[model samples]
Target chain A: MTDTDSTTTGPLGPDDITADSPFTLPGFFDALAEGRLVAARCTECDTQMLPPRPACYGCGSRAVTLSEQPRTGEVISYTSVNRPPSAFEHLAPITVAVVELDSSARLTGRVEASLEDVAIGDRVELRIDDPETVDIDPDFDLSYEEEWPAHVFELL
Target chain B: MSTAHLIAVGSSPLGKTDLPGRDLFSKALAEAFEELPDPADVVDGLYVGAQSERYENQIMQGTLMAEWAGLRNVPAERVEACAAAGALALKNAVRDVRAGVHDAVLACGVEKMTAGGTEGATNALGAAFERALEQRSGITAPATYALLARRYLHETDATERDLAKIAVKNHRNAADNPRAMFQQAVDIETAMDAPDVAPPLKLYDCAPVTDGAAAVVVANDEVAAELQRRSDAVRVAGIGSAANNLAVAERDLTFVEGANVAASTAYEDAGVDAADVDVAEVHDAFTVCEALLAEAAEFAPKGRGIETVEDPEDRSAGWTDVRINTSGGLKARGHPIGATGLLQAVEAYEQLTGRAGERQVADADTALLINEGGVADAHTVATVLTATDGGA
Candidate 1:
């Protein structure tokens, strides 16, 4: 077996990860795996944060709890990286986009399609893909849902 | 809202100065204090603006500057916001004096970027971006501005020649500035054909990483009246600041919203329009930044800033009307981040006082200074300065 193959596990098991390692999929990833996106809601300010931080950037309150988030979102803006860093060498010419979650929380991720199909206001859905094979893994992949087919723009 | 007057303006030689930011600051402070008619008088407060503490490893910079400048007992605070650190520090000093808390204060900005290598300094600047989203994506300041330059060219009629003309004009202006980092002139062709640092941004299009410091002493109207009896004084009419998202992807790439907001607020406070500005020292960290800022600040109409720079009629003799970056700006003046904002203020002080020998705008009455801390879309500060002896 090759080194690449050795690193590419079918699915990460609980024993293969740790809390300190960013690669260890956090609790949010567990929810994402179940098709339920999660965010953190501050108890004091009712502010929702996706890919949740330990404290609220808005009100600076640590009293926050995990809550379910809308899996659908609209693309706020995006850019195409013709050249990427070493770790993402395999992912050059990729389109990265900022998506405003249906709940109004913003998060960024790699859009898994041609750049032409993506644009501001394009609808996107959170989907899971094996992180081991991608150049820069975000623990999950993003793809357009079937219902928003007309909104997609094809990359030239 | 409060009245603050510039009593003294001085700088350590700005170039490839071998001294660190602290040392450069000390030299400039010594000169400023010596220039004061009463050098022994105690200052009520001190403010210093620095962009990065990661390289300097010196947190609590205000205390450090006060100690080094021999003002141990004075209350000192460091104001940081990327390149606009010094401008914001001056604004804070103005606020303190206006509130009747302090009558006299010293504001200084210093940056020692050369102590670290090029890559180290570049990475330190990248810290201003969103760590997880933008910085991690390999988007440095140059690349971010390059993306904007591309978009501006596509949406508007700007070309590489238009951008190069800004560099040529600033370089010629710098030739007359004795303290400018680059005092040599270059043709438009030389600027346009320089090596590419990032796509659409040539070597001449970017400011060099520099080490320098600038200081200005601010006082209230009473103190200003006293200073006028002794020497020339420049009065601060208005100050404004605005903050935007750290990530470039979050906003429109072609325009700077923070600059527009800050300029509008300052103009409103000064009760003057863009047409009234006799001279302006704007942030030109990149060539395109100056053009976009001119339009966004209403100094020129949208997409017409390029024409303003390129048109010979707009830059005729004895005209100097609406002069932008007369001191070469950060593009050729050297951008020692922390000191950049203060340097711009110093340029205005010199222009208004007729002390800027060769580069002086004839009979200047009102001047504006705009300083930005991060990339075009980040933190920005704008201030208006008027000659105390001159009229509206």
Candidate 2:
């Protein structure tokens, strides 16, 4: 469980929804940039949500706490985007996968490998990259999303 | 409680059209109001379903569509749930009519998807997925559904060839449909040899980007009787919808549980069972979806949905005799995103009233429609319609 003084854990009220709270996107990405992958672990039902939110989807509870996530997970499913959106056309045929992290919080991200190399159950580790390093078209990024980082997976 | 009746339905030609979004809506509106009285006399309110403003760079579609329909003011608004926006509009209209809020309401949907070309359409549709994770990873509509398709294949005895046959079947069905975007039948070899849009999903497996519109007029029983004969009307017997997990990874990979809930709810509300449905038009954005939805809607047994391509007698024992996607589904009839769900209703209207010319299913008195938006069942709307004279 997350024990950092900077992050608060437990059910949040309306007053606790500030940008600084890990329940918000800004705080979640901020932690990721600093090498801390945080998820909101629902205390009531144990649902782990990546990009920590205020409530749990599992049991619809707001009684969630901050939980630092493990980097390694297995690929739950995999596919390749042969004709991607305009912003990512530069990276056509990008192999992407739905990965369940070691803590059971699942998310989707690009896999750093060819489609042929990746398979379901392949062990992979999450790697955070600065948004600028990814070379996504600037036009695709909304003004508020310009500074956000992108996540990718590398086969272990 | 008032009974909601679908009095009339109409659609613009489905394909890459040379019309603006409003013009497409006008075409549908004109066709819908053709046999009925003017919109000013027949309807009290309007709901417009539109997926994105990116293509036309416009919002306020509710006001725009209302004005075009010559409706001055009576609760005009827009409803959206990505591709399921059309059915969402219809649901709201039915609610209004059933609750005595309006005697008649117009539910319409429009999309000019071809305006942006392939890349622009791709970018616009990309907004439907969970933005923070999936979008950043470069996922598109086909790609997200491909994720579902991949896991489905891994767990089932179904093969890639089985998926190809779904395309072939829909194409063959489309060949007989006058309103289909693709009117020609394709062989299994052609479907199998098509270029891959995403692994496990080929070009043929994906629905085309279409420019189209559909309009449905829902009214109370009194207004329906005033407008048309009882035999010509179809009853909105039941409605159900669900919003599942936005992120693809978080939800069940194969079951499409949300769709199941929606379908089951609609069946219960309609006082009918899956076996009683003579025809169905489901969301087939991808070939795998047809199979997935077959099971979700309880028309086929689990892991045996691929038998959708076979004859009813040839399917597994647990499967129902419901005819799936007789309008060629989204695969060939054309998926105009915002207009798709209403298009399904249009086909149902045709079948239930005995107007579906060549592709008609015999004694198709009861019909089901399942429209979904986002990755699989991130949002779903299931509706059951029965002919007024068919024992409803």
Candidate 3:
């Protein structure tokens, strides 16, 4: 229990719902901070939810289990945010993409590449970095999110 | 079950206005109730759609707007679904009247998007996207839709120019609409050359941050007959709403399945088909949305939605004859977030009643309105309105 556990075989019960469980945001980030990208694999519909959740949206089932996800994926679609939110204004003209991981769990993240350089179907690798080191405004984080890691992608 | 009728509709000036949110609501309310009786006399319930408390730092909009309209006590409440809020308000009102809960209900929406400048508006709207993964990645409204546009172009015969033409067509329609924010038409070349808010989504491709409000009155059959002439009222024949994935990454990039479900549900409820619609006001918040929604609403065949720019005769064989965004849509009419869905209803009301002068479609008896919030169809409300006399 000392190590952040990202894998769980489920049909989870109320006792299993705690901060240390990957089903909650705190536990999900805890595992991510330790370099384990976890997803809630819905037993009912096989839908993969990144940063695991308690319930499955695909088929409305609560029988979700955690599985560590592969870091590599391909870009399904991409864009550049010329004007981003105020918290990320310093990083304007940010290139972002929706990447489907090797496990087929899709997530959107900032890409460490120029807008002109990325294309659909391009291979990329997910990278987790400490939030403070990412140059994002500290005010962007809520009190609980201050220590959470930020994710980005680099073209392969 | 009682029939829900849209008896009257009104809107405030749609643009950068000095008026605050409540005052804007007053403007819209004044017009809606001008010919009819006082709000309290005509309606027994109220619903107000307001997108954010960030602008003007206000909440309890339902109470505030109801008070502004001179209604003291009633079952008034606020509703929110980002951009789809306005229509959600109308849907609630319709449901109440149809259920015999209220003889009449006032459905209105207002937003003071200009209260904060562009930066403030950006941050306020940023709350609409999925926070955990999408917003953390710095995805703005245009950027998320750009993902859909980028993939749509890759999968279909649509080009950047084809998308630009959507802006052109909507602008042309807007020029003819007296209520549009941008009443000046832009050619395809200008739209194509516009600055990129996000790649695949140029400045013209996006709807402006507008300050506006709209109000619609929904009444039962008996109430409608007492308040207005039969020809003046439009029947709220059907309404359907759906919430899709909050994250844009998880949705179908090319097709808006949720909108399709909502529209199909509405079409079924109305006992009509896509072909029966004579005019439509789909959420053209972005140029690409017009095309995507046309396909989603079943007005155009799959991947041929870009043909929305073409005249009905010139479009694909499977395309419906419905003219889209005749009130300039969100692209030109002005999108004031919470007020947009009601604005679509305003346009439909005007068209169904033959009040749309310059941009009026011939025999536009049946109308469809699709209002979407968040990226793509994360939330969608589709309503169908038919002329009371069936366009006799």
Candidate 4:
């Protein structure tokens, strides 16, 4: 239940501990490579962390486990970006969605659904990003979209 | 507690210009100083609220801003709080004067967005939101605000027509403002039918990419008395600032919580209610903001800010006495990001001093300026300003 011991593959010393210790973005990608979705879940209040953070946004609890994320969520909001910035100029008219996962954590990802099929409260499920399709756009520069803009949700 | 007053104000034109950011700031400042009798000798400190360094291709801009403005060796500080950067500078200036650190301070906010064009401006502007969550999604400010606008429509039984009312009204108001960036007034049809930037939001619904600078001299009692003979000063009665959770979803999507908190703080500090406000400059970054912030500031009861737009004179119901965005707000006054907050201050000063000409409200005694950063989330800086004396 302690954050110190919850990491699955981290090799930490007795005093060494970190939030991204075992759960880096690459690690999230690793899990996705294995067809699984994982996020930090607080051991105390059960607040789920997406794009995981070191300190818990709720209750400031650091004792959390990088557990399997909920497969499904509901669309909370969406915007169809017709005129994206220079980094995303090629991907104009893309629909981005903010989804609340069943685990109660929220993250933004592209919704692989038609504007007609998707809505504010529509159900969605996490879909892994395709390595072949994800071009590492250096211009976005440390943006979550740079890392996971293609990591998306499917209408369910 | 000691009080601070806005003794002088100045602004560069709010529109596309070839001037560099520093020159715009200098011009605005030069105009501000021109209003004062003792100019540089009176300023003990300076705060510059400039925008994204990416646009200007410069860093550590305060010294350069002072140098460009011909300011000689005054203690200077740079303040940046996204779109509220200017307001933050003003807030710090007021605090400095009230704390007896400086007798007179200059707060300047300047931004040159047109230099980079629309995409460049969009990228720089997008940095105002949470980087980890919102920015990476390839969302522009219009797209982000449109999300709120859409949700607002669903929740409030309001339509695009209601939002258009803001665009129409602000434009109408700005038509009388000579310094406003957009002087042409638009009807509801013009607003609703303007080319789409983001659906449910159109070109007219959003603020234009403006290049401008605004500056104000905030001074204590002694300096105010000295400057009183030179210009009409407005009392900085109360100022309030608050921040909402960075994650927009964590707060109510329908209302701007930061604005509500900041407005309440300003109201409490000023010892006045919504009834006392004669004129207001709400941050109308987008049309939805006009509605959301007016309600958040409690100028209109819940779900009723639309009435302030739909019918400006129909204050018979719960819609209060305040006429919001008397300066056309960001929508028409022009939004130069960091400069916007100080621009609101400039506008409020104009309205209260009876110098606003056609844009002037009759006998405006008290005014409020609500400036915000982020898309419905993040910092809201609200300042309550009262005229030194009742105006004609």
Candidate 5:
């Protein structure tokens, strides 16, 4: 019952959920730019939220901290986007996965692997959205240079 | 402890049409006022639901519909929560009556999805998602729910066949409805053979892009006592609404937590349980929706919700046996966004009064409706309706 390791930012966070923004897929880009996958963890109940959150999904607490996530996760479910939206027309036939992390929380990211190789329980490691393999939507015309995150996963 | 009473229910044909949004809304409103007791029962308030204001190029729809539908200069407002807009609009009007603010109120909704092409409508609807994950990643409505459908089968051992059964059942039910878009019954074989829109979700598995309107008139208990046509009114027993984090990945995919909260609140307010719901009109934009919502409404247990919907080949154990979606649901009856909620109200009124033709649930005493906004984009409104004489 000695739960006083609240200040440590390594896995178990010490910041409040409200103090810093939860990484909504759009908001997560800042951290991703620095090569980190962070999640918002409830400071009070120790619940973690991937794609970050304003409140804890486990205990409904607003006292959450944005903490870095483990690099590994298991595939929960996946689909091949044979027909993608117009924004991603160039990236048609992308592979998507709902990856549940070993540490805490689940997130959806594109999986770069053979469709036959990926299974429900297969493990995958986080990979950055590299331009070589990653095809981004055309944002050539815009007032603001928007960064649409395309976080990917490599089959373990 | 008095609840609002539904004095009249009205809807027009549910299908693709060239009618302007105002005209569609007015048509349903006019149909609703057909049996008004008297001019003295003036509509003092108007609430309209339209999911995509941009689609119609019309804003201030509540005011416009109120004027075009024959009532002008009354308090009016428009509400939107994607597919749940109509349900919420009805709830707002019901609340107006409940709050003792107006003797009678009109709640209505309309959507003209066909006016815009399929791509245009899809984009308009996509405005309802959490832009961060869903839109940014190219996940559309059907695809989003497909995630749930995929996860449901994963957890429950249910098959795509189970989902097909729901589509078949709804199509069968819609065949009896003249106002329904697709009145011809769809067989399980046809549903199974339809092209997949998203993996695990066939084209038949999704509610089509429809255009229609529906309206309901509600009055306070005191106003109900004086109405000329009060004999057939159904009491608005209870209403509950709640939402979850808009992030789809973080939430429990198997369970619709928001519907659970909303339905629980509505049940408590209505002083009834799942057993008391003789019929239910749920927001089944996709087949998986009907499965998840059945569980949220407590029509079935956590793991067994899909079992409530029988195999398409077997009618004995189908959802109709339990009287769910006796109106064919969003699947076959058609889903016209804002109008769908009031369409549920219309169906519930018809069944409760024993006026439903072929799709009627025999001796239906109470009804439950679950109208949802977007794919768990965080809003759910649950309403329970009953015959005036049925409950305390």
Candidate 6:
């Protein structure tokens, strides 16, 4: 598995890369690798942010740190783009969704796998894709665990 | 505050123009001023609305316009607020006159978007987005609207066909509007099948990047009455503005909260409801925006705006009772950012005064104009104009 193989599966090119390439946040990526999730907490505002920003969107203060998040959260909303922008032309019919982190912040990312299992308020977990071994970038290749613990949905 | 009436409104034909922003604005201002009985001596103050100084690398637009339009040395002020810059300038000018600070004022909005290349113009317009996040995410205005359109489709029963109707209707209306940038009418098939710029949104769904300006002279009752004695005058019944979070992620992506708030404030101030509005000129920067705005402004219920348009009564044709975007809106009229809000006002005045010609709604007595700036619903201005004089 190499970057080229990942490109065959995901959306990326030789020059296409993420802001975070060589450096990877383990706690963030490891959780996804283990089918869990994580986010960053602003020490000042106590606000949680996903796709983690270095600083707080609320307080604008740089006093922020990372935290492991629960695997399960409600899907606040979702949208399926039949046609993506030029940048994402290779990845059409992509489902972009916002999952409300239990602590308050919301995580926006692509929802891979089947659309039938996904619904607003459905519980989902982080699912990571190994891009280094493949041709795609891990950040763009990551997805969500569609099968939820029965209790997660039954509890609601 | 004393009442201020929009006595005169004017604009250069909107399109791809070789003229500079200042020159375009000056031409519109000249037309507006010349419409006044005593053009040379009437204006007591001038207000100019501009979204960015980076585009032209200049500031103090009102002073420049004042000088260029031959109304030199008048007190001039510039207002900036994403796309709603023009409406904000008008509000400030109206405030001055209503406060009796200035008997008469000229409010103008101008943007030379095409002067800069597409990328440069996009960068300038995208400045309204949350700098750190949007820049990192690389979400341009179209992308932001695309996200909304996706959400809208997900939550509602509306289809691509419904959104295409908005484009078709606006373009058809634009065909009759001499000032519209794209006067060519497009059918639903052309709009729906157009090439996609963003997912679920096509080229026809978006507004053009235009260089244009719109100007209006607002005056107090005394001045308005004097102007009325000589010519027809359109009165401003109410004005309202609202602000919201600048990031699309921060907002309820399903709704434009800022537009809702602005509409409530304007309707309340005007002592009327959405039903009273005979015609509307809304900020339809994108087709989905127009649909979402129709709901947000209380013209229709949530998730039912598509139904409203589909309803025979809600059609854009005459006798529809409530005509929305008769001037083609931003889609066909062009989105000259800074000038859009003031252009809405101009449209309202034209409709109320029965000067919209082929696109005029029959017996249009009250009109509503909505202008929004930024991707995150940052700023919204909603104004209600009535045929009746505000002075009385």
Query: Model 5 chain B, TM?
Result: 0.94
Best by DockQ: 2
* Cα lDDT of model 4 by residue, A1-156, tens digit: 223334642132444343334355555555565666677677777877765545556767667566677679898778788888777777677687778888777777767766666788899987776533644357677544344434677898
Off by over 4 Å in 3: A1-11
DockQ by candidate, in order:
0.10, 0.89, 0.86, 0.51, 0.40, 0.08
- Reported per model, the fraction of native interface contacts reproduced equals 0.05, 0.89, 0.92, 0.55, 0.32, 0.04
lDDT of 1 by residue, A1-156 (tens): 011112312133556345432222354454454555556666677676655556665667766655667667777655565444434546666566656667766665666776667766778875554344343433212331111111111222
- Candidate 1 chain B — worst ten consecutive residues by lDDT sum? B311-320
Q: Is candidate 4 or candidate 6 better by lDDT?
A: 4
Q: Point out where model 5 deviates above 4 Å.
A: A1-27, A113-117, A130-145, B37-41, B311-321, B389-392
Per-residue lDDT of candidate 4, residues B1-392 (tens digit): 57899998999988999898888887888778785765567778788887688787876677776676556788887888778889999999999999999899889888889887887798888887666546656778888788788788878877888888888999999999988998988888877778878878888889989999988999999988976763489999999998776756455678898899898999999999988998889888889988888788888877777766744566547777788887888999899988999999998888888899988889898998888887764788999999888753
Question: How much TM-score does chain B earn in each model?
Answer: 0.95, 0.99, 0.99, 0.96, 0.94, 0.94
Backbone collision tally, model 4: 0
For model 6, how big is the iRMS in angstroms? Answer: 6.9
List candidate 1 stretches off by more than 4 Å: A1-156, B37-42, B315-320
Report the C-alpha lDDT of model 2 over A116-140, residue by residue, as the tens digit: 9999999999999999999999988
Task: Tell me the tens digit of each residue's lDDT in model 6 across B1-392.
Answer: 77888888889768778889888987787677664665447778888888998678889787788777677667888888888888898888878987899888988899988767775677677667764323323346776787788778888888988888889988888999988999998888888788877656788888988889999988888888877642257667788898886767667787898889998898998899987888888888988888888888787778766543454464443223477888889999888888998989888888887788998777788888888888736799888888853311
Tell me each candidate's RMSD, in Å, in order.
9.2, 1.3, 1.9, 3.3, 4.1, 9.9
lDDT of 1 by residue, B203-264 (tens): 88888888899988989888777666433788888888998766565556677888999999
Give per-residue CA lDDT, model 3, range B1-392, as digits (tens): 99999999989999999999999999999999889989989999899989999999999998998899888779999999999999999999999999999999999999999988998999999999998888888889999999999999999999999999998898899999988999989988788888989998999999999999999999999999998998999999999999999999888888899999999999999999999999999999898999999999999999999999999999988999999999988999999999999999999998988889999898889999999998879999999999987662
Better of 1 and 5 by DockQ: 5
| lDDT, residue B294, candidate 1 | 82
